[model samples]
Target: MMLIDTSVLISMFRDQTGRVAERLSALVGDGDLYLTRFTQMELLQGCRDEAEWLRLDSYLEGQTYIEATDLTWAEAARIYFDLRRKGLRVRSVIDCYIAQLALENQMTLIHNDRDFEVIAKLRRYRQTTLDTVRSTDFHENDQDAIL
Candidate 1:
């Protein structure tokens, strides 16, 4: 399973070379793709207007949705505390939640944000950046090496 993060979605919209589309296409039509509610909030918050929000919201409605429970929140806090103990800090609290949520659910997080890099280092959750995806032929079997 894979959790699609907001950064990658933005990359898909802003990149003109079609590399993002090519890589993401490799995962489409599979039943394994997913996104978190936190991601949905982040995406919706970035919309320019209600129309855009409605369009994006409708599109997101078709995705596999992952809901975070109270356990997810607790574990996210614990992960942040542990990272702080190690002198590492993820800039986004929501990124921390997303990472821990993915870990809790056994999902590999596909993201473009540097925040995930920081989160992954401290937690060992699977993740690959948009930069990595854009530069390679992404395959399910070779996921570990994609980033």
Candidate 2:
């Protein structure tokens, strides 16, 4: 499984030719896309208006959602402190939680955030590269792209 991050979701929602959106299309075709509550909350928190909120909510409803266990929170705390001890501070505790969720589930994170790069270096979780789709010949009828 591949965990979807809020950064990727936001980019996908705003841009159709970006790395995150294109990667999402491919991953969805492979049946490897996934999402956690952490990402869902983060995405919902960024909605600018009711229309966007409903749109995001509807899109998320079609996704497979996962929950982080208590043990995952414990690991997240441990990771936060460990990074702090090494003089690395992630911008948000939610990022730590999401990273731990991906680690515990052994899923490759599909993200556009660089903070995950810091966490990945220490935690050793798998990640997939996202490259922008620069061509103009994108498939308009693709369900994944529409999502």
Candidate 3:
């Protein structure tokens, strides 16, 4: 399974080449998508207006949401301190939560944020950037056409 971060979701909502959106849709289509409660909160907070918030609420209404327990928060705190000691500062608590969720769940993370790169490198969790997913889609499409 893949845990999606809020950065990718926000980017997908903003950009319309349908790049990140398509990638997320592909994951959902393949039944490989999972979402954490932290991600839901972050995405909801990202909306600037009531209309956008309502839209997001409606969009997420039927989706599965994973809850982070006390264990997850404790682990995230450890990850935050560890990264801070390494001179890699994560800008938000939400980032740490997302990283910890991916680590504990053993799920590959799909994100467009650089913060996850540092966390992935340190924590040894699998991660893929938006560009990586896009290029992968391109390659897959090329192979399909050839076949």
Candidate 4:
């Protein structure tokens, strides 16, 4: 299974040509999709108005969202401190939580955010860029030029 991050979901929602979303859709189509609570919260927070929030709520009704437990928090704390000691300043607590979720679950993360790339390189978690996934398809050669 793979863990998806909020950045990829937001990009997908805002751009139809977004490779992240396309890959996510492909994963879902293949029955290999999973989501963390952190991702769900981030996506919900992007709703600007009540109507949008309701729409998002309705859309997420059947989705499964996983939460980071106490063990995950301990792992996140360790990761946070380690990254800090290495002079890497993660921008948000959410990023740590997202990374922790992927790490603790032993899942590969699919994200477009550079933050994930940094975390993957430092922490040894696996990650793949949307561009790389898109490149697997002949029709997706224009992804980089999309937006």
Candidate 5:
């Protein structure tokens, strides 16, 4: 399964004709796309008005959602401290929580942000960046590379 990060989702919502959106469209049909509660909150927070909020809220309802539990929170703290101790602190604590949530659920994170690069080094979760998707030739059988 794949966890669609806030960055990628924002791009998809803002630009339906963009590469990020195209990639998501190709992968979404597989029924493996997902979102974390943190991601949902981040997306909702981006809304400029009540109408945008309602539109986003309604769209998000179709996605598979995962909520963090106490265990998830505890582990996120550990990850935060560990990364800090290693001098690899992520830019956002919420990002740390999102990473932990994805790790706990064993989902590959799909994002357009570099913050996940640090988290990827410290965890076992997989991450597919927007650049990676764009560089990959999805036209041939190599489509599996993105899939």
Candidate 6:
């Protein structure tokens, strides 16, 4: 039903206050939670050690993983071009790819990145607000913050 973005996952694990955990628990009970291969790549790139890698991998293994077909990959580029034509941009191409995945699949994205917000505005897509725990992960500015 929803794709958990890497930014939100980072926040969930780093948040000492437990708010992200509470939200994640609710999502887990609400049908299926999903991850894109792109999100997996981004997350794995952040792991500091084999221990951290295994821990995160073990948790991610429980979620449903989604992949892009050739057509979908091309579609992602179109979305990028659409944004560029409009004089808009997100932080990364992967955000565009991830947005395309969620948009096509009709899955809401649980994210803590403003890139998703920008992508959402380009074409309607379901999104929820979340934060990167404290100040260390994502910017705290109201405009840049995401869910």
Model 6 accuracy (lDDT, Cα):
0.74
TM-score of predicted structure 5: 0.81
Q: How far is candidate 6 from the true structure (C-alpha RMSD, Å)?
A: 4.8
Would you list the C-alpha lDDT of every candidate in the order shown? 0.74, 0.71, 0.70, 0.66, 0.71, 0.74
Q: lDDT per residue, candidate 5, 29-105, as tens digits?
A: 67587788776767776666778778878888888888888898888888888889899967777778888888888
Tens digit of lDDT per residue, candidate 2, span 1-147?
A: 888776666556657556656667876577667788876776776666778778888888998987878798888888888999998877776778888888888888877666788887678888764535322222212233223
- Write candidate 3's Cα lDDT for 20-77 as tens digits: 6777777556756778776666667656677877888887786776678789988888
Can you give the TM-score per candidate against the true fold?
0.82, 0.81, 0.79, 0.78, 0.81, 0.84
**What does candidate 6's lDDT look like per residue over 7-48, in tens digits?**
777677666778878877776675688888776766666777
Q: Weakest 10 consecutive residues, lDDT, candidate 5?
A: 138-147
Q: List the residue pairs that clash in candidate 3.
A: none
Worst 10 residues of 3 by lDDT: 138-147
RMSD of each: 7.5, 6.7, 8.7, 6.5, 8.2, 4.8
Model 6, residue pairs in steric clash: 111-147, 129-147, 130-147
lDDT of 2: 0.71
User: What 10-residue stretch in candidate 1 is worst by lDDT?
Assistant: 138-147
- Which is the winner by lDDT between candidate 2 and candidate 4? 2
Which pairs of residues collide in model 5? none
lDDT of 6 at 143: 27
What lDDT does candidate 3 reach at residue 111? Answer: 82
Residues 68-103, candidate 4: write the lDDT tens digits: 787888777777788888998766656777788878
Clashes of 6: 3
Model 4 Cα shift for residue 70 (angstroms):
1.6
lDDT of candidate 2 at residue 126, scale 0 to 100: 80
lDDT of 4 at 50: 75
Candidate 6, residue 2: Cα displacement in angstroms equals 0.5
